[model samples]
Target: MGIVKAAMAEEESKRQTAVEILMKVGFLDHCEHHEEIIFTVGGDEEVTGAYKYGNANWTAYQGSFKDRKDMTDHIKQESENSDYANDGCEICRSMFEKD
Candidate 1:
């Protein structure tokens, strides 16, 4: 393949890997919006909110996970000191309540 084609292919591979990691970490539901695949946390759109994974913003989210293990570890760390109720984030409260 040409240089540009090879580079595009590699980026696409990384994007697919990121999607798999997110889904394995409980972000199973996703939707396409404005050329981006927005994955909802905990499979709920209204509760846990969503993360945009696409060409434009992939770099930001991609760095957070080297693999599925890393992605899950990040979630565990975030939940360790999470203050859903006291923080006044209704979505967070609802998400925790569902657990």
Candidate 2:
């Protein structure tokens, strides 16, 4: 991979590692938003991904986010920035248009 791709991958790895850290700290088990988190890496729209899982589905959570809100909002912001209007998600361009 090129330097940029390598860097991106490394960043993604770091992001995931932060999440693992959260796992070790019991954030996923104790945080108020533990059950619902937006999982993403790289902050790249093309290859970036977002997924949500409930607290019951996970055992641990850890990270370096500003706070629980930041942790929960990252994926929502990413999905919104990507302009994805899926009903399964929280927001969409269509919703904005409808308002």
Candidate 3:
């Protein structure tokens, strides 16, 4: 019972961390499921990005920013406050690396 409880707690923690990362990046609304979560990104009410996370995988199919610099800046600033700031999703590991 204790072991099962511990695993459940860990899963919840990971889910929360995923939410925190998405929220910091401007994802205010999301759809969650047992196997995955999805979020739509908007800039000036225009759809900019489509993001999905599943089983530890994070994927960004599109991005809307002034430029690469702008995107990087936004990500860097928001991630600074998260516990996973230094440990981004595998797909984003390169984009969110420490400065």
Candidate 4:
């Protein structure tokens, strides 16, 4: 079991490094599943990007932005097109319905 433990430790180390890099780039929320990490960029209030890290690399899984304006435009468009009834949690659906 020593070899298995060592491999697990190495993977944990890699995950920590990836988390550090993501945090530096403004990704504050993350979910880990096996070898993959999914990140929500620019905080929970407004996610400017969605990224994934695995196999020692980072990928912009959702969309890429050229600048702050581009990011803002994308967020605005997404908000306008969002179907909260179908997409969001119960609380979010209630909040959107109340708006």
- By lDDT, the best candidate is 1
lDDT per residue, candidate 3, 22-71, as tens digits? Answer: 56446433433212333434332221221222212333311233344434
List candidate 4 stretches off by more than 4 Å: 29-39, 43-99
| lDDT, residue 59, candidate 3 | 31
Q: Write down the RMSD of all candidates, one decimal each.
A: 12.9, 13.0, 15.3, 13.3
Please write out the lDDT profile of model 4 over residues 3-95, one tens digit for every residue. Answer: 999778755554444444444455433333322333343553333332223212323312233444443443443333323213224444466
- What local lDDT does model 4 show for residue 91? 46
Summarize candidate 2's per-residue lDDT along 34-96 as a digit string, tens digits. Answer: 334333223333222223331222233323344444444543443343333222224333465
For model 3 the TM-score comes to: 0.31
lDDT values for all models: 0.44, 0.39, 0.39, 0.40
Single out the weakest 10-residue window by summed lDDT for candidate 2.
47-56
Worst 10-residue lDDT window, candidate 1: 78-87
lDDT of 1: 0.44
